[model samples]
Target: MSGIIALLDDVAAIAKVASASVDDVVGQAVKASGKAAGAVIDDAAVTPKYLQGFSAKRELPIVWKIARGSLFNKLVILLPVALLLATFAPFVIPILLMIGGAYLCFEGAEKVWHKINPSDHHSEELVSEKLSAAQLEEKKVKGAVKTDFILSAEIMTIVLNALPQDVSIWMTGASLAVAGIIITIVVYGAVALIVKADDVGLHMAAEGNSGFVQSLGRGIVRGMPTVMLLLVVIGTAAMIWVGGNIIVHALNELGWHLPYDVIHDLAVGAAASVPESLAGAVEWGVTAFLDGIIGLVLGLALIPVVTKLIVPLSSWLFPEKQATPH
Candidate 1:
């Protein structure tokens, strides 16, 4: 009986330790996830565009497929790669992170450039001529998944960097896993709602039993475009700001601290001019705006390189045949 009580006490201690570890993992995951908010917002914002031309009934299913792919990207691919970096190639994390940051800068800049010079922006037309609905869905899913891979890579790296260095390997993994799941659900769930809002509104407008309900439905339908535009604008700004910040911080890590210091000084100076209540907000806004400008400049520089060199190389490597019209 004494032996049993001793064993029970040991088990209780183990349970307590396990509970603490779980709490730690959850806390770390939430904190790290917050660091990747910009990327996550961009991801959520960007996804709705892919669903734009699809039929109403097909929207949720497509979102589900993309969400599944995103989960797979985060869990099956990025999670392992992040763990490998943490375990073995820890030194390379910063390098990979910078690369991702540069990509974001390029992307954001390209968006700004495209907005300024819309005529210059072009994509290899997805010749979906003969594709049936199922085929089209498959292609879109594949494209979304490909896009998700890039964004997910950025998110995972950012999260990994944000985590404490002293946590156990499993704890780190668990944190990442939790972050991935939570982010996936939040982003896709929001996308799903955004995409379906119009449909819901239309249904309510056309079929609602009350005048107020119908009016609300109309409002939703009309408001969707503005909401989408807002999302895009916010997402682009976030990408540029976050991308530039990442690059600045990465350069600092590499001992190039001038840009970081200058930006900090500028932010401080800007903050000094504002009221105490708004000082922080003003400072952050100024910093973000400057970072976006930096990102835009970098992206504009990369555009010529990407279009003239990268695109040609990619096309040469994977030439596409003409598709027959349906």
Candidate 2:
């Protein structure tokens, strides 16, 4: 009886430790996920564009397909890469992060430049006679999955960087897995809702028996365009702020801290000049604005290099056009 009691106590202790570890990992995962919110918001905002022109019945199904692809990208492709880097090539993490951050900056800046210039919108859709509906859907899904891979890489790297190096491998893995699953679900689920909301609203407006309910439905339908616009605005701002901050921090990590310190000192000085009740908000806003400015400038610089030099070089190296033997 004594031996059995001792064994039971040992098992209980093990269970307690396991439970504690889980709690710790999950806590860290949540915090780490927050650091990638800019990418998350950008993901959510951008995904709905993939549903355009698809039939109503096909929207959710298409989202599910893209969501599965995203999960695979995060778990099978990016997560292992993240872990391997964390374990072996830790120094490479920050450099890759800066590259991803620069990408975000370029995208955000391009959006701003367009907004200021207000160029005429032109549809780029090609009416290929050989392409069927299935092929078209497949092409769109592939494009979306490709885009998700880039965003997923950014998110996973950000999450990995957020973790402490002292953490055990198991702890790190658990945190990453949890974060990946949670973020994938949140992003795709939001995409589904956003894509379907207009249809649902239209249905309710057309079919609802009561006048007040129909009015509410019409309001929802009318508000969706504004909602989408707001999401884009929010996402663009987040990309610029987050991208610039990442680049600045990376520079700091690489022993070039002047830009970081200057931004910090300037923000603090501005905050000190503000009213006491609103000082914190003022500081954050100023910092974000300056960071966004940096992001914009960096992005604009890259635009020419990327468009003229990089694109031409890449085309010469990996030409998408191949001569077919007739």
Candidate 3:
């Protein structure tokens, strides 16, 4: 009887420890996800665009396809790379982060530039027009997945960096996996809702038993365009801010502290003018705003270089295959 009681106690202790470890992993994962908020927002915002022009019945299917690709990108591809880098080549992580940040900056700035100087160049759209419905759907899914790869890389890296330095390899992996799954579910789930909202609204408007329900449904349908535009704007701003923050922090880590110091000092100064309760918020906002400005400038500078040099070289090196629409 004594031996059996001791064995049961030992098992219970082990179970308690396992439960605690699981909780820790989940806690860390949520915190790391918060650190990668910019990329998360961008993922959510960008995904809906791929569903455009698809039949109502097909929208969810496309989202599912893209979500599957996103999962593969995060778990199968990027997760191993991130863990290896964390294990062996930790120094390279910051450099890769800066590169990813630069890309984000460039993308965000290009959007701003396009908004400021609207261009009629719809080359992709034109190409898409030539493809059959199935082909176009495939192309769009491929494009969205490719974009998600970059963003996922950034998100994973950010999550990895956010973790405590002394965390175990098992803990790190668990945290990252949890974060990736949570983020993927959140982003794609939101995309699914956003894309299907119009259909839902239409159905409700047609079938609702009450006038208020019908009116609300109509409002939802009418409001979707504005919601989409708002999402895009929010995503763009987030990318720039996060990109600039990453670049600045990376520079500081690399021993060039001028930008970091200047931003910190400026934020401190701004915060000093506010009440104590609001000081923290003010400081964060000032820092974010300044970082966004730097990101915007960097992005604008890269635009011409990317357009004039990178795109051309890329096209020369790996030309895209052309396919006619059926």
Candidate 4:
């Protein structure tokens, strides 16, 4: 009897420790995930565009496919890379972040440029060319997955950087896994909701037995366009702000601290000019504004370089076959 009780106590102690570790992992993961909000928001916002022109019945399936790809990107690819970087090439993290940040800046600037110079945009004449629905779906999924890889890389790095240095490798890996799964669920779940909102509204509008229900449904259908536009605007701003902040911080880490220092001082000055109670908000706003400005400038500079150099190099290296119209 005494021996059995002792063994039971030992098992209980082990269980308690395991429970505590699980709690710690969850807490840390949530906190670290918050640091990557910009990337997360942009990820969610950008995904819906891929579903455009697809039939209502197929929207959920496409979202599911992309979500699955996103999970694979975070878990199988980025998680291992992040762990290896954390363990061995810790110094490389900042460089990778800057690269991702540069990409984000380039993307945001391109969007702005295309919007301003709509005539300069690539002719989508090829879009109307005949392609089986299956082929088009495959093409879009592949493109979404490719885009997710960059955004996922950014998110993982941010989470890894936010973790405590003293934490064990196992803890880092476990926490990252948790964060990735949670974020994937949240982001794709939201995408699912956003994509299906119109269908649900249309159904209610068409089949609802009451006038009020029909009006509400119509309202949702009408409101979605504005909501989508707002999401795009917010996502673009976030990409610029986050990208610029990452680049500025990376430069500081790499010993080019002048931009960082200048931005800090400017934010502080702005904060000082405001009331003490509102100082923090003012500082953050000023900092983000300056960061966004930096991102815009850097992005604009890279625009010509990318169009003239990077795009040409990419096309040369991996020339895409132009599909002939049947």
Candidate 5:
């Protein structure tokens, strides 16, 4: 009787510990996931274009395919790399993060530059002209997956960096895995919804028995363009703010605290002058704006390097024109 009671007690104790660990893992995952929201938003905002020009029946299938690719990117590729970095190359995380931030800055700056001096949008049109429907679909999926890999890499790295310093290797891995799964699901699920919404609206408007349903369909069709534009604006803002914040934080970590300190103090002072109810909003807006400015400048600087050096190297390595058969 005594032995059985002791065994039960041990089991209960073990179960309690396991339960606590699960809670911690989930809590940390959620918090870490939140840290990558800027990237997450950008992912959601940018992905629907991959489905553009596809038939209504094909849109959901395309999104589903891309979502699976995103999962593979995060889970099979980036997650393992992230874990290895957390375990062996811990010191490299900050550097990689700074690089990623610079990339974000570059992308955001390009958007701003293009907006200010509007370039003809030719890629999609050209692709549409050159590729068959199947070929175009494949190309879009490949492009989306490639883009997702970059974003996933950044998200995983940020999540790894956000974890507690004393965390065990297994815990770090678990938290990151959960965060990656959750983020992938959230981003692509939202993307699926965004891509299919117009189709849903069209079906309802044309086939529905009710006039209100038809009107709603018309509204969705009209609203899609605006929604896509809003997404672009939001994505650009997020990239700049998040990128600048990462660089600023990296600077502080590297013992150059001046930029961060100045920004923090300025935000505090600005908040103090605002009404109590609006102080928090004012602080966040001001901070984000300043960060965006920094990101824009850094991005603009990188643009020349990318265009003159990186682009040429890539083109050289992967020439669009194939060699003729001997």
Candidate 6:
């Protein structure tokens, strides 16, 4: 009858609205993920190191445990905190972003400094020597999860900052949840593959059916070290670039436009010289390059402050307990 037809139309309209909302959530989630690329990459790059000394059998389980902790960090702890901030004290967001950005720059710069002036510190190894296998695994997992909390906080904050200011709380929550799950899966999934690659290669080298397969396996085993090094380098560069970009943008938001203006002009000038087809790419590259330079300089300046003042103060305030070797 006519009543039934009207109800059908109403249901169809509701479905349309629901579908549009879902699409919006997904779109925002993807965009937010892109904004946190530096942290995500660093997470992936750093996680494999925790697996370095563990037997192959324990690697995947440890990765799984860490991944679960990362998820809890983002979803349970950070997501709520981010939402509360956006709701009650939105002004604090940019300050937090700057702090996180500065941290990224400091970490990236420290890596560069260490590379230039390598020093052997076997503190972890020394500690590990004292613990049983199970205890060592527990300790490493705890350390990794603790590190993940910092990175996860940065990722969540970046995602929240990337969202539109007018979005509803529900929309914001959905976007963050989606972004967190996507990033966690991607970072840990990649870590799993990276850690397992060597074992796979070794297995192939030993047990492959044919010479060609065995040779390919051998190549993989030989190539993994170079791949790990490349990943670390890439991660470091990403941290510096993203950190610098965040700082400059934060400064611009806070009404100091000098750095922003200078960088924009430089990018524009660089783009002008390139072919029209390559103009956009050239501009982005130039901007990223400048941002990285700023980050490196800032990071280098912070190193001595962090080492001389911050580290000493922290150690004094919360000195670590020395464990006697069993």
Provide the TM-score for each candidate, comma-separated.
0.88, 0.85, 0.89, 0.90, 0.85, 0.84
| TM value for model 2 | 0.85
lDDT of 4 by residue, 1-326 (tens): 99999999999999999999999999999999999887898899888878878898999999999999999999999999999999999899889889988888887787788889887675543563456888788888987888788889988988998999999999999999999999999999999999899888999899999999999999999998888787778777777887898899999998899999999999999999989999999998989999999998889899999989987897788665432322
For 1-326, candidate 3 gives per-residue lDDT tens digits of 99999999999999999999999999999998999887798789877867778898999999999999999999998888999998999889889889988988998898898778775346655777778898989888997898788789989998998999899999999999999999999999999999889888998899999999999999999999898778778878887887898899899988899999999999999999999999999999999999999999999999999999998897778665322431
lDDT of each: 0.85, 0.83, 0.88, 0.88, 0.83, 0.88
Off by over 4 Å in 2: 1-9, 111-136, 320-326
RMSD in Å for model 2: 3.5
List runs of model 6 lying over 4 Å from the truth.
1-23, 120-143, 209-211, 320-326
Candidate with better lDDT, 1 vs 6? 6
Q: Which candidate would rank higher by lDDT, 3 or 6?
A: 3
User: In model 3, which range of ten residues has the least summed lDDT?
Assistant: 317-326
Model 3: clashing residue pairs?
130-325
Q: Could you tell me which residue pairs clash in candidate 5?
A: none
lDDT of 5 by residue, 1-326 (tens): 99999999999999999999999999999999998887788788778756767888888788888889988988888878888887788777778778878888887787787778565345535656777788788878987787677688888887887889899988988898899999988998898788778888889989989999899999999999888778768877777877898789888877789999999999999999989999999998888889888998999899889989997897799776323110
Over 1-326, each residue of candidate 2 has an lDDT whose tens digit, in order, gives 99999999999999999999989999999999999887788788777766777798989999999999999999998888888988898888778878878887877777787678665222223332345777778877886887677788888888887888799888898899999999999999999999889888998999999998799899999998888777768767776777787798888888899999999999999999979999999888888888888998998888778878986897788675422110
Order the numbered candidates by TM-score, best leading: 4, 3, 1, 5, 2, 6
**Model 4 misplaced regions, further than 4 Å:** 124-131, 206-213, 319-326
The residue-by-residue lDDT of candidate 6 on 166-220, one tens digit each, is 9899999999999999999999999999988988999999999999999999999
Compared with the true structure, the alpha-carbon lDDT of candidate 2 equals 0.83
Clashing residue pairs in candidate 2, if any? none
Once model 1 is optimally superposed onto the true structure by TM-score, how far is the C-alpha of residue 293 displaced, in angstroms? 0.7
Candidate 5 wrongly placed segments (more than 4 Å): 1-16, 116-128, 207-211, 317-326
Q: Which run of 10 residues does model 2 get worst, by summed lDDT?
A: 120-129
The top-ranked prediction according to TM-score is 4
Evaluation by lDDT, superior candidate among 1 and 2:
1
> For every candidate structure, what is the RMSD over all alpha carbons to the true structure, in angstroms?
2.9, 3.5, 2.6, 2.6, 3.4, 3.3
List runs of model 1 lying over 4 Å from the truth. 116-135, 206-210, 319-326
